[model samples]
Target: MTESAFRCLACGDGHSVAVHKAVADYFLPTGIRVDYVRCAACGMVQQYPVPTDVGPFYAAYPVHARKSLLQEVTRRILLSPVYYDVASLRRDQLLLDYGCGDGWFLDRAKRRVSAAYGYEPTAMQASRVAERVGVQVFHDVAALRAPLAGRVDVITMHFVLEHLTDLSGTFALLADLLKPGGTLHAVIPNLDNVEYRGFGSRWHGFDAPRHICFPNADQLKPVLDPLGLRLASDRFVPFPNTLAASLSILFTGRYRLLPFLAFLPLAIVWARLYPRGTRALTFVKHEN
Candidate 1:
């Protein structure tokens, strides 16, 4: 109804480019209609008119959880480097998982890191995370005071940072939670991927309201660097099932097994063709 406005979450650069105005209903999982835009200055993609109620946006999370064999294999494929990138595996190493929904990754990270904890904004999912993974989940950072302060060795945010409405506050909180050389690991959708170029507004990754910010390598660098964090390494790790799902979405607008007919070769071809474009990334927080 009204023209939306936005200031760049990274550089404070404002924009008014109407790249595409579409509703992402089914895929968002957040169940909120969203308006998408692209920045003219830095080419970053983001959602406009931030949602007022963050509740329904994350309400369907725990209720509609999925951890199939395909998801497990994909996690292994993309998470290997994340483990190797940390390079400090030992017992009693306290780790915090920001926005850990259902604690699937936390379940695995616990095996490597001595101590694992997580915080989930969604109340329903946060409860399940603790019940399922045996880790405590706070409603927000402010809830975590003396106990978690300055004790976490590694802080992780998998597919989490993009949803933040406050980067400065979020990062500052994460920074405070970490020990002196502690690292903050995050994985998010790659805005520079060729799949987005080929699919345009139909790109499956842009799940609208849920994915508020679709940042690329360049967009993320300046944002994190100011927080004493750096992009230690970034790589493309393709998930065959997700790629197949994308192909299904592009063709028929719903996931189907028929397109998975050439699942093997298609996966390899897509991975090779657009390696860096895959929604794969591993970043570490650096200490000054």
Candidate 2:
């Protein structure tokens, strides 16, 4: 691994050591090589030498992608079963979906809660949710001050944490927004899982430069500790959808196979055995 000067994204208190080198998928044509690193002080992991072209990375997300039929199937099969179990959601609770691309989850969440809203930095994406789902979608955290302060019961970040450039600041803000005893449900790739271990640099979850930091529970603890959030419970979902896709890329360097086929048997196995610590995870804040 090539060495580069780096600091922890969360605590900013570590010497970052180079872990691996890989090409990024976010800025496609550029094909920039990024050096992945692990923080010595806090154990937080991330990529160094990120490209200046950061705006295009998130802008590429298609508005309403979640509303598509395939995404709907995956959402039901992958997300609802593992992360969105109804027991955690209660009536009269206010729910917020951070980085809620097109408000699909926001729409579904409204069914179980008194109010549901979404926050997306992308204007075009947020507008699509506003027009299609009819749920309130704010441009950023600042915009939600009036409606969200001390009111949200549960905050959900589905597949969104991996893309953030400000990990600690975001969670700190989340702590302030949540009501006492509020739950923060986040689903991101676990860097310490078996799949990630076996695949090494080729893991599909890497998603290259776009995935700025991939942390396990140990690495994540330091980031969440200051916010008074604790890991109430954690589970892993080893759905093959992403594993198959990553393996395909490792072998052929192209992902042309149908997305459903990639996840079918894996989803079945995931449904049966219910692997925890790879595909999905959840956490709740401590009411101090």
Candidate 3:
């Protein structure tokens, strides 16, 4: 509702509007109230005064938690197609799954591709992935670059970009890692979602402190084009859980399923809309 000197993390725009102000009611990692803003120029939504150390917020984060055998099997059957199609993965191509958590996707992807690698933020996760999946996982940028620079054919980010602080720097590193004609595939939550309108700060998409930014697709075009990545395909990815989770926060204080049989149809309708609750975008690196 108000404008200030907030510097947008994605586009460097000065003009912005205060969007939401809320405590971490759902996550409760920190009770401190955080303010969110959307850049008027770029339409990127982000938190103000980005936390100095986000470690505490993720202290109990289930980002890489092991899933049950049934959960793992369900994920393989349902989620693998999204990445494979977006990346156009082939048996001859090498893949690097940036922010690969638990290596579940990479575990299967390695079986299909010529080679597969992973990048995680912690040594514990990197080690778990290496042992469990037998796929090489790296936490050091320098070490990753030494081997992968201009060699990887595809890189994937699954609900990972929003948690990162450095958008520009991350894309630059992606450009360095991918070969010409390579692909950068991602799945991101859409702020344009009708759920955000209905739930406001309580919406799961806001996810407050952990999810730092929600950059519009248009703003990403200029950010990626100069790095030799072109937006090749963009479409909404159905996120049935968004509405249910938001409703849970509205009724219950934490994340748990509530029978909202009435809203199921609305979630289905919103998923098909242009400005959906979630989206998948595929960008192809230009061949020089």
Candidate 4:
């Protein structure tokens, strides 16, 4: 391990423990092993040697995978901003979906908000999503920031915070993009999940280099406070894909539909009982 990866990006802790080594690239089998390190001070988990050329790693990403009508309907309902009420959005409001991914949410959001913009870092995918969803999708962060800074009423980042390398910078940039009293809804993987203790390296939340960090609300308090981003509220929410993936790893190394279906009810019940899984954290910008 080197100095860069050894130090915790979340809390600037210099010491960490290598929790999981030789972690496979589960999404695409890119043949690159990612080592997991946990900060002793913050208890935040992150990938060692954080991925730089993650493009190759995301080549076979499943966000674009075709789904059955039932799957699509359920996904739309469960993952939609409408599901979480996205800061109690209204038809007069403007919203931004950072790393919006295929614009499914944006499609749903159009009926509820005055304007919906998306920022997908992948240019090709952004084009396709823009064409498919008929929304202003910006591939460049500078382009996204230039026009919308301090103007957007609401922003949503779904399982996106974990994929970035720069923690403080990303938060600051997102905070800067918000209108005064605007809200940011972030869906993050909960590191405190009981499954994390049972699965360790096999936990789907720690998706190797693809997911740079896990839920670190405690560690991030210092980072968000100065930015005027207040933690309005947060709650445990189960992402079916996350549960299915974890259940798959529990059964085999990959997805198994029958077993996944069989155990899903139990998993949902367990998630409710323990109440630590995917977290929907809402942060509101101060009105000053």
Most accurate candidate by TM-score: 4
Candidate 1, lDDT over the whole model: 0.67
Q: Put the candidates in TM-score order, highest first.
A: 4, 3, 2, 1
lDDT of 2 by residue, 142-164 (tens): 87876787788888887778877
Q: List the residue pairs that clash in candidate 2.
A: 236-275, 236-276, 236-277
Q: Using lDDT as the measure, what is the rank order of every candidate, best first?
A: 4, 3, 2, 1
Give me the runs in candidate 1 sitting further than 4 Å from their true place.
Answer: 1-4, 26-32, 62-88, 256-265, 272-274, 279-288
State, as a TM-score between 0 and 1, how close model 2 is to the true structure. Answer: 0.86
Model 4 lDDT on a 0 to 1 scale: 0.78
Instruction: Show the lowest summed lDDT stretch of 10 residues, model 2.
Output: 23-32
* Residues 11-123 of candidate 3: C-alpha lDDT, one tens digit per residue: 78888777886647475546556778788888888887666677666766665788889767746654654454634568888999898988877876787788899998888
In order of appearance, the predictions have TM-scores of 0.83, 0.86, 0.88, 0.91
Q: Count the backbone clashes (under 3 Å) in each candidate.
A: 1, 3, 0, 0
**How does each model score on lDDT?**
0.67, 0.70, 0.77, 0.78
lDDT score for residue 288 of model 2 = 64
**Lowest lDDT 10-mer window, candidate 1?**
78-87
Model 2 Cα displacement at 129 (Å)? Answer: 1.1
